[model samples]
Target: MNKSQLVFVPCPGMGHLIPTIEFAKLLINHDHRFSVTVLIINSPFDATYNAYVHSLVSSPSPSFPTRLHLTLLPSTLPTNISQHHKGTFLDAFFENHKPHFREAVSNLESGPDSPPLAGFVVDMFCSPVFDVADEFGVPAFAFFPSGAAYLGFLSQFYTLMERRGVDTTAFNFKDSGMEFAFPSFLNAIPAKVFPLLVLEKGWESFSRNHARLHKKARGIIVNTFEELESHAVLSFSSNGGIPVYPVGPILSIEGPSNPAQQGFDVIKWLDDQPPSSVLFLCFGSLGYFDQVESGFLDRTAEVGIVIGWAPQAQILAHGAIGGFVSHCGWNTILESIYFGVPVATWPLTSEQQINAFHLVRELKIGVEISLDYRTGFSNGSKTEVLGAERIEKGMRDVMAAKENEIRRKVKDLSEKSRRALAEDGSSYINLGRFIDDIMNMK
Candidate 1:
């Protein structure tokens, strides 16, 4: 008869927020006795943040039963000592917000118990949650809000940094060469384009701080399916002294759309090209492309429809989309597989490089572009800047009918994804297990 409160604490970014919301919604729908709360990060993003939150709770759910709530913290900005804020004005933001956040959690710990605070599911970047959980003497779990392969890369970032040495660490973007070897598929990318988060210098302190915080958590919750990342998730569980739950394809929380899904008109936009003829492109909520990157979009337009932000679940459900030109983010990957769409990986940052690498080299479903390590190569020749032609060609190769072979290979994966979230699928089982595990934890 004990009611449990599952609080979802996400990172500051949209990519993290959306999927975590979906997970929270799923948890809420799973059982009537279980209630969910989305703990706001308390940053500038709070403005439009609540809208996304409202959309979920406002919708009707026929699956399980429960209600979703929101808990907003004042807001945590970057700090002067924070890696991303340093040299910028907001570096010390976290420093100021830490005490306020500490107070908030303490208050929650001491609050009334209609649905008592049973546990916390925190984002990987929310460092304050770890200490707050310890302060309250409550178990807190880390949510990566990304795929499993990316987790593997992050868990080993220290090793990658140590092996590369201080010289590479000190190198700036302008001077950086192909000195660092990235793990996963990103390892082959030039040292420059690996996303600012992976850069060792000037950012080392932030990375170290996050790694330490992650290790101290009770467990890690990943938004993925076991069929897709069983090995990597297992690796995390074994090493982290915490179990890593791969409960994802949570987008299915939208439930069955059935016949209307077939009539979902957008499929006509992709008809008659070829099987796997389309390359779906979406950057999630915050993935923006500047004029320099515009050519990549233009070139891909030649072979496929270029969408600014796709209703991914709807697009993936379509029969026309054969491949996805994705950021290799966890949610995208999970959704793609759920709909059986193979991927064309382009990792922007964080665990993307590793996710991209695993997709291309390990999963054999996609391909990635050169990461511009400043080796000065143009289509394998010496060049000043990255020309659009090569990117165009890469898109052509990825979207070609012959490459339909890759699509054929991914068909089973997609079906598995579909089956995973289905009634008896692995994702469904894991979700039930997750609630049971947390509720029963001592």
Candidate 2:
């Protein structure tokens, strides 16, 4: 069989880029007929983004020996563009790159020796590029780095508006007391806990545009296992005309982007502690941050390490990790599940509150710290400090669980997650199906 090329366009964020690369590796390693080239959007703001890419480009992992190629799209957006306003930045970046991206793909395909361009697999954030895919008469699949549940939750707002005939231009999310029984979530999620993007005023149009772009895509590729979010996965089949592929728990099991973040000191420290003793408080790349109070240093001398970037997977895998006080990012949630550490959820932004809701309420794999905290506000305003009691309670609930069942469930799921990557596993089978779908094209 002839080899095929798939272009992966992941936004410059570390969380999204890392998993996309891993998925690329999985595809090429599992089936020799596919080769991937990840096209990176220029993000000068994130200092670590390029550093991480450089690490992967320099040294590939052994376990999954992917000849995954990297190409950085030039900085086409003008320097005069305001980085402060996210909406302006997103629109500018998305629109500016269409012609540049088209030209780049044209160059890749110009050589007669190049493999047939099978499809464009893009990050959820880059949905606008489906237009580019259409230009080439190639299918584009939006790769949502988050889980199915979050995607389902996002679509619910739009679905509700469509069903109710609510005008997107006129509608305002002023009803704080509102609640909806989103299909993915087992219980009705409150308006207060909805992602700020869906609720905030100026963002309504952006959200609408994003959903519109998504409709143009051939399908969606979610980063979750069928065994984990079976309900949300099944829901997509009945609802949208588009297909949904849940092939994941896709992780970089090897190491981080920076070689300096290697786990020597942190591992040594973890080795010193007893089994199930440490409560980890690391967040994802942006540091949707949390910190211990100075007064409590004497009281709790230990959640103590202040390293720049610890080996998160290694730390989660350690015997000393009792539980995680997490920001509830999708990747973080999966890692916690894979490592069998129950989460004490402290959601900061994006779909994190929703994730925290699903984990604590729907899935029952974790407990909540502050589900609605700091999730509803952006633009560097609204920084409500959590009371010491809430922090203490969260730490207490995860480590010393009132519901021992949460711990037991997480432990069981960890084994299942590992198996999902194996040949006979659900994700493995879905991954094969994903490849077949690409080959069939559509």
Candidate 3:
């Protein structure tokens, strides 16, 4: 009857934290001999995340609340740490949580209901915590919530730079024409589409540290399915580095859409739209639109309701939604694929550029808004405004054909994704194998 409890340290960003929770829920739901405790690294920049965790802890008909525990780490940002900090400040932000995690693990060991500590599943950004995991004398995993391709970039970029003697210092973002033979992609990857932060002035060291940690973990768990990224998924096996577990399309909580609940009006609005007509353009919660200068009151809102936040999965699932104007976040990419909605790929940051490339060039399931249009906190790309023409073209191309090649592929993958998560499917079997790895850790 002994159960091994796994502690997951997910990064504070909603894009990262939400999926980690879903993965934790899956573990406890799929098997009875395992339990999960998700250590929340709260973000001072966003209270929405705070509300999210509260909802998980306080859900009325909880999914796996008995065996799943979500609690805040004691390292909530202090007065000295400014709310508007970035760059190395984030490094300090994650580093400061180490002792808090150590203390939380200590407290868990003493708790009456606590199971034997299995190990730690550290998010890609929370690599500093691998040190604490090392101290605890248990294995640690690097949870890459994005996908196999992004994981491939992090796993190999250090070698790409060092072994080739490529200079990180002199790298220029202006060389949009250059391409690299990155291992993950089917086609040669354009240099311009690589993550902006990794090439920035101060982030090289940070990127290297992350690359180093990816090697240190016993394995990397990706929120992807083998059917979706077979090339990138298979690349890990040949390299003979850290093992990878593609136990995903590990999606967010999906309950029946209710008219009375949050995001009801948006859903109700969509109820009137014709099938394969509406295009959902959501940039995730971290993104924003002030919408001040334009004459707001006179607009009919052709592109569905413009809300602060959305039940994205529900909207995408609706027959009304045909194409998604996406930031190409991995979660949204999988969701778009799951719902059979094609994407107008517009990458904002992180490895989204590579994701956009994957969608447009490799899978042909998306059209590009601006493949190399990198942006940051202040929208620091060469052209920030993204002209109306380019945006229109992206939307038009994706929505151009109802039963086109992109649509067909998306539908096929959607069906395959559903099966992959079902009993005895690829992702399902992968999840079992990952769990077996944990149980064997004992």
**What is the C-alpha local distance difference test score of each model?**
0.63, 0.79, 0.80
lDDT of 1 by residue, 1-442 (tens): 7777766777655667767777887777766677876766534434444555444345545543446765666754554333343413222555456676666656655766655777778777766667666766668888877777666656666777667554445557425655444332333444554545555455556556666645787667777788877666666656545677777766643432333235445556766556555667776554655544678768866665544434567767766675667667666777776676766665555556556656776677776653332221112233455457766665776676743767676777877777877787887888888777877874
- Compared with the true structure, what per-residue lDDT tens digits does model 3 show for residues 1-442? 7778889999888778878888888878889887788888667567767766666555635445577787776655534655434656777777778889999888888999778888999998888899998888889988989889878877777688778776655656436476677788779877778786567766766677777776689888999999999999888887777779988888874632333357347778888889899878888666666574355534745544555557889889999988899988889999999889999988878778888998999888889898867676434444567899999999998888799988999999999999999999898898899888877876
Q: Which stretch of 10 consecutive residues in model 3 shows the poorest summed lDDT? A: 255-264
Residue-wise C-alpha lDDT for candidate 2, range 72-174, written one tens digit per residue: 7776764676543565566667777888789889988997878889999988777668889989889998898998988887766788867866443444442
lDDT of 1: 0.63
For candidate 3, the per-residue lDDT at 29 reads: 82
Candidate 3 global CA lDDT score = 0.80
Q: How much does each candidate deviate from the true structure in C-alpha RMSD?
A: 6.1, 2.9, 2.7
* Stretches of candidate 3 exceeding 4 Å from the true structure: 58-61, 76-85, 169-171, 174-176, 253-264, 292-304, 378-383
Task: Pick the TM-score winner.
Answer: 3
Candidate 2 structure, TM-score to reference: 0.91
TM-scores for all candidates: the values are: 0.77, 0.91, 0.92
Off by over 4 Å in 1: 45-66, 76-95, 99-113, 163-168, 172-195, 237-240, 252-277, 289-308, 371-385
